[model samples]
Target: MESQPESHLLKLRKDTKENVRKIYNLDKPGRLEEAIKILQHWIQKQDHILKKDWNADYLDKTLIASKGSVEKAKKQIDRLCTMKTLIPKFFEVINVKKELPTILDLAMVMPLPTQTEEYYRVILVKIDTKEIKPEFFMMYFQYCLSVAEYIKTHDYANGFILVYDCRELNLAEVITKISTVELQQFITLLIEGYGARLKGIHIVSESKAIEMLINIVKQFLSEKVGNRIHVQRSIEDLPKVVPKGILPVEYGGNEKSIKELQEEWLEAITSEEHMEHLKVMYKACTDETRRNAGKFNEEYMGMPGSFRNLSVD
Candidate 1:
């Protein structure tokens, strides 16, 4: 039979090597450094391969071993056969130029995939590494881009939709009195401008937008910690996490500022009329139910209603 494919031969040869085997010897004596070095090499190889072949990826692959019999596994695989998601095949440690035996590091992960992909690449490193740090947001956007790109190229074949995921992100506390006008400037750019490559952005999460707003409201919130905020801003507030100096071309009257957006938001959120309209009902517990609750004696709870359990008391 013809020799195994060049890739298979490469794999087999490496599998036979002592250095390659060291990658898996995490607990072996004197192998920790080797394992780290190997993993780093693997990541470098992935980077190189991605930059080399347009259709090849270097992410590790996975095996699906179900608890069911072979038939079930086969059926499961068949079901997934139609899925559009890329399946990771397995991982390998490719050799890198002599770095260091003491270079073994762990915890940082290197991945390999079955096929090469066009993932979303954000240019936020420049901004993040500078100021108004978004914290792990670039990575989130990276993943979002990957999923969005995969769906776009695989499913739509060529179309656009307003794709944004704004589930949540931690709101960083900022100086209470400082004007976030600079940051708002950045938000305009983010919403209006595209990503690094100017390619169509199919997905953009709005979490950072929320984060910035939190920063803007820090001033108001400072007055009442733990109390609910009565937002006086309009619902269409501009983002507050924007970088120092950048604004989108699209603003009210084709001209606006962070202050204006904040004002609009204030109008929407703080209007006394709006507050009354926006009821925070507790499902309207019936008056009869309230009376019943009062009738429940201390025996049911096995405790006195006002025994003053505080340590001081």
Candidate 2:
């Protein structure tokens, strides 16, 4: 007889954590390709669970597979390809180096041998398990159009990924979603300008990436801008936020692991002595802050001056 447990969010989180640990602990992994087989088995298991009227089990199983290896991950996606089935809180762990650059409409990094110009890569990853709806595809299409318009207006050549092909619904009709206002303008101005094979006044083509900048800036300065959004979301650009002359992104200082920071902090700041000594503490806090800031600005952000003059107090 089959057993059933009630559904809960905490259960799903626990299941995901366990699965991620299991995957990370894979012992002397034979080949990366084997991850695909584990994923396929997971897909089958999930399909069977839901078919048996076990929603909670289905969700737990799906979350586990979501964090599996890329091949397994892609197989996990087989259970979720439709826009109608996506649940909003869903998440999948993916490696930035291996998975992201390939699944999108444009490659952010050209393959090794090409002459493509290199530019800073900015990306935003939004994870949702929102029971995927057909309307969601429309939302994605609009977002892509907006991104393209922003890029074009700013003279930036960036790439994007809508990444909603996880639910079990057929994503084929995503075509319908792509026919929004921004894409329409891109077709007329960019595609037609280059005499493209237009799709009857609907659909975005590769050429429309040209207009992403124009639309993005307009929305940023317009009523559409919101507090929740950022132009860049990945921590990859963290070091770059500070001026680069002093601390470089590639330098060992800025890139030091969290363990190293904790060690350094413990070695220097004794609670009693630093607290009692005012001038010594002031010089340590202010001068150290300035030095670190100066290093960060000169080396990471390319700022002209060190941040020594700015007083913390």
- Number of clashes recorded per candidate: 18, 55
lDDT of 1 by residue, 239-260 (tens): 2222112222231122234344
lDDT of 2 by residue, 1-313 (tens): 1111221100122233333435544323443235545544554554312222212323333333243344444333332231111211111222222333222222121101111122211221222232434444334433333233222222111121111111222223333333344333333222221111111111112232323533543442223322212232223333343222222123222333333432332222222332233222112111222234444345323211222333332
Candidate 2: segments with Cα more than 4 A from true spot: 1-27, 45-79, 82-121, 124-313
Candidate that would win on lDDT: 2
Residue 248 CA error for candidate 1 (Å)?
A: 32
lDDT of 2: 0.27
Instruction: Candidate 1: list runs displaced more than 4 Å.
Output: 1-134, 163-313
Q: lDDT (0-100) at residue 6 of candidate 2?
A: 26
Output the worst ten-in-a-row residue range by lDDT, candidate 2. 107-116
Lowest summed lDDT across 10 adjacent residues in model 1 is found at 55-64
